[model samples]
Target: MDLLNNLALGFGVAFTFQNLMYALIGCLFGTLVGVLPGLGPLATIAMLLPITYGLPPVAALIMLAGIYYGAQYGGSTTAILVNLPGESSSVVTVIDGYQMARKGRAGPALAAAGMGSFFAGCVGTLILAAFAAPLTELALEFGPAEYFSLMIVGLIGAVVLASGSLLKALAMIVLGLLLGLVGTDVNSGVARYSFDIPELTDGISFVAIAMGIFGYGEIISNLSQSDENREVFTDKVKGIMPTATDLKRMFPAVLRGTALGSALGILPGGGALLSAFAAYTIEKKTKLKPGEVPFGQGNIRGVAAPEAANNAGAQTSFIPLLTLGIPPNAVMALMVGAMTIHNIQPGPQVMTSNPELFWGLIASMWIGNAMLIILNLPLIGIWIKLLTVPYKWLFPAIVLFCAIGVYSTNNNSFDIWVVALFGLIGYGFIKLGCEPAPLLLGLILGPMMEEYLRRALLISRGDWSVFVTRPISAGLLVVAAILLTIVLLPSVKKKREEAFVED
Candidate 1:
């Protein structure tokens, strides 16, 4: 009954004329970006941040939330239509999705992604609705020690699960932590790593770093690759709707992916991105029936699993951000900015003070996801044409948009320069065979790890045992340690070797 009441209140808010319009607008634009390779939700969102300032907070968030999930749906379009992944999370989808497309079963491959995403997104949203309040309560009891331990686990999870060398991931994380220490120390009214630069006094802008690493870095990497081999959309494209057989195969994968994603979604750090590949890997590991579809040769389950997992993971990620004031990833960090701009405190107190926004946003996920299905399904014919755009033309527009977005952040050219520098750095990372995603994860979480560590020590009079003293804190740290150890083992090393070995 209480849940019903809350949901009812949410409906009242979400159904408002203004909010609904924004949702449609956001979904439309989001799908546009998703269908284009080398462009992503982060780029579009950052560009729109300035524009959204004029709208009411609730309406603004609704639109942004729509864009987030819509991008998830639309991204699958390019991954299936072309070899290019629409987003990092969509990377695994490409392994089998493109194969299905090549087999002239592109309709089913895309339909599975669409249907699975919608189903999983709804389930994920419900999970968030049921669990958010209780989770926030759990977050409230956490002191600096608990937070420090949790952050430790998050950073470790990011590095351990990162696709490349664990050593490189850890090193990147350490560098991020060091960079985070550049501003004025709150403990003492003195600057530390500013080196007498005024902009350094406030520390690096999240916008600058996020845009630098993800937005600009990506452009740099894309430009380094030879476009000569890139495939253009051919006349092979046809009806976008799936056949009856296509729906039959995708259902099981969707259910399996939903379960995996729901569980993984609660974990900190890139759970959305990880769950997709994890589901794909699991599907491959399972038994292969005689005459059953091969793993990478047009398996509908392959298309279904990762899409469902990623969408489910996306929705559940908001649970901690809204309830606990803890941002598990960079995108969530932006939400923190959204909340702050609205004068929301972003802690457990948020539930008490801004129940409307909390419940409204939660409810809006269901609507946003439904809107995506409607936009991406029967309407997919329009999106397939989206893949026809050439990368040579598209990438330059992205570079320009990123440049304009970074410039608009502070109305300063400093961030533009940073983006160019990071673009080169990004290209270098790609050339060196290092996964840029983990570096991004490290860059985003580095400062938070340091802050929590310092605060925990301050509360405990500099006694280091506090992290291991509390039950939750100790458990988390132990998990981190175990994860770190597992990544170092010979077996894991051999597995990663095989991934690149075929190369």
Candidate 2:
């Protein structure tokens, strides 16, 4: 009964004229960027973060959330049509989806993906709404020691789940923590690493770092490659609806994917990419029906399962951010930046403190999912036409937008220079095969972790045993330790590397 009343309040807020418009706009922009092979949700969201400064917090969060999941819908379009994945999560789709397109079954494949995504997104949001309240209730019991121990678990989970060298991810996290220490100490009047630079006193701008690393850095990487490498799909797509038989087969796959993805998304570092990869793997290993297509040759189950998983993962990734104030992935970390900008502290208290914003954001996700399906199907041609734009022209506009956005944050020219410097650093990370997502997590969580750790020790009169003395804190530390041990084992390390390899 309380859930019904809360959802009713949410719908009342989301149905307002202004919120609906922003939701539509966000869905459109997300699809546009998703269809363009090189532009991804991370870069798109980072570039657009500045524009949300003037929006009401509820509206801003709603739109950004729309963009994140809308990309899941649009990414499969390019992957199916041109065999080019618009985002990392869509990479598995290209295997069977593109094969379906080649055989003139693109319509069924795309329809299965779009419809499956819609269903999964709704289920994921419902799960989030049901579980978030209980999770928040549990989080309210945590003290400073427990909070700090939880962060350690989160950081280790990131390294364990990252699809790269564990050592590289650890190095990135350490770098981020060091960078996060560049501001004035809250406990004392002394500056730490400011080097007498006025701009450094507040530490590096979050917007500057996000835009530099994700926005401008991506632009540079995209332009370095020749345009000749891209393959455009200009074929006419016929019959956008799936047959009854196809729907029957796709329904079960969607259910399985939604279940898997919902569970994974709540875990640290398990977002759309990991969910999609796992879904496809599970589908391939399952028994096939008589007369069904083989695993790799245009299987409808392949398209449906991953699309459902990725969309579901994208939605449920909000659980950690909303409940515990921990960001499970980079996109959610950016959401933390967004929340801070609006002067809202994201944590267990948000539900009690700001019911409208919390519930309205949840409701808006359902609206956004509906908008995506309508926009993705009929407007597919328009998105395909957008792909015709040359990269040379597109990148210059992106660079200019990023510069203007970064400068607007503080209206200071120094921020622009800061972006430029970090852009170079981001390129270095890319060249060195280091994933920057973990770094963003570290940057966002580092200060909070330190604050909690100091508070705990201060309460314990500098006793180091306080962390283990608390049962909840000790359990979290044990989990972190076990994760680190698993990641370091030789057999597990080799298998982790193998799992990340593209088929």
Candidate 3:
């Protein structure tokens, strides 16, 4: 009954005329960015941060949220149509989706992606609505010790879930933690690592960092690659709706993907990228049905599962950000920046103090999902056309936008230099087999973790045992320990590596 009332209140707020329009606009923009390779929601949202300043907080958040899940919807289109993943989560979709398109089953494959996304998105939102309150209650019970323990679990989870070398991921986290230590010390009223630069006093501009690492970094990398072998499906799409047999094969895969994605999204550092990869890997491990196409061929289950998981994971990634004031990924970190700009602190109090913003955002996701399904199905051709635009033309405009966007944040030229510096660093990461996602997670969590650690020690008269003395904190640490133990086991480590191994 309380849940119903909260949802009703949320709907009442989200259904407002202004919010709906912004949601639509956001969804449209999200699809545009997602349809084009080398663009992503993180960079788009960072570039658009200035625009959100003037709007009502609820409207701004609704639109940003729309951009996120809407990207999930559009990403599959490019993957199926061109064998290019418009978003990282869609990388798995290209394996089978492009094959289906090659076989002239593009329309049915796209339909499966759309339907799977819609269903999983709805389920993921429902899970968020049902579990958010309970999670908030649990978060409310946490002390500084528990939070510190939880962050450990989160960092370790990132290492465990991240692809490529565990050593690289851990090194990135440490680097991020070091980077986060820049700026004025919270308690000491002194600068820690500012090196006497004024702009460094506030630490790094997250906008510059995000735009550099994800936006400019990506552009540089894409420019370095040869576009000679790129393929675009110009063949006519036969049918926009799935056949009866196709639907039967897809339903169970969607369900399983939704379940896996929803669960993973709530974990630390888990998001669409991890969920899609996991879902696709799981589907391949399942018994091959009689007469079913092989996993890398034109299997409809391959199309459905990762698409569902991607959407589901995208929706549920909000849990940690909203309830615990932790960002599970880079996009959520930008959201934290957005909320800070609006003077709205994210955490347990948000539900009680700002019910409309919290619930309205939730309500807007459902509406946005519906809008995406309606928009994607009919406008498939338009998105397909977008793939033909040459990178040379597109990348310069993106770089310009990123430069202008970074400058607008603080009206500082130094920030532009920051973006350039990090662009090179980001490209270096790409060359070094390192993942930046975990680094972003660590950077966002580092300051908060330090604060909590200090507060916990202060409360315990500098006794380190306080973390292990509290039952909840101890249990969280135990869980982190167990996760570390399992990941370190030789058999489990090999399987973990193999699960993420790219063919």
TM-scores for candidates 1 onward, in order: 0.92, 0.96, 0.97
Segments in model 1 whose C-alpha atoms lie over 4 Å from true places: 42-47, 287-291, 341-345, 493-503
Choose the strongest candidate by TM-score.
Answer: 3
Model 3 lDDT per residue over 227-283, tens place? 875677866676789889889889999999999899887777655778889899889
* 10 residues in a row with least lDDT, candidate 3: 34-43
> Tens digit of lDDT per residue, candidate 2, span 1-503?
88989999999999999999989988887777666665567777887888889999999998888787666677788788867776667878889998888787888888899998999999999999999889999999899999999999988888888778999989878887888888989899688899999888999898889889877776677677777865555565678798888888899999988988888888786566788888998898889988788978988999999989988888899998999999988888889999999999989999999999999999999999999988888887677677678878777777898899888888999999988988888888778888888888888889989999999999999998999999999999999999999889999999889777757
Ten residues in a row with the worst lDDT in model 2? 229-238
State the displacement of the C-alpha of residue 120, model 1, in Å, after optimal TM-score superposition.
0.6
Positional deviation of 181 in candidate 3, in angstroms?
Answer: 0.8
lDDT of each: 0.75, 0.85, 0.86
TM-score of 3: 0.97
> Mind giving the per-residue lDDT tens digits that candidate 1 earns over 250-301?
7777888998998887676667877887788778887865656888787888
* Sort order, TM-score high to low: 3, 2, 1
The weakest ten consecutive residues by lDDT in model 1 span 494-503
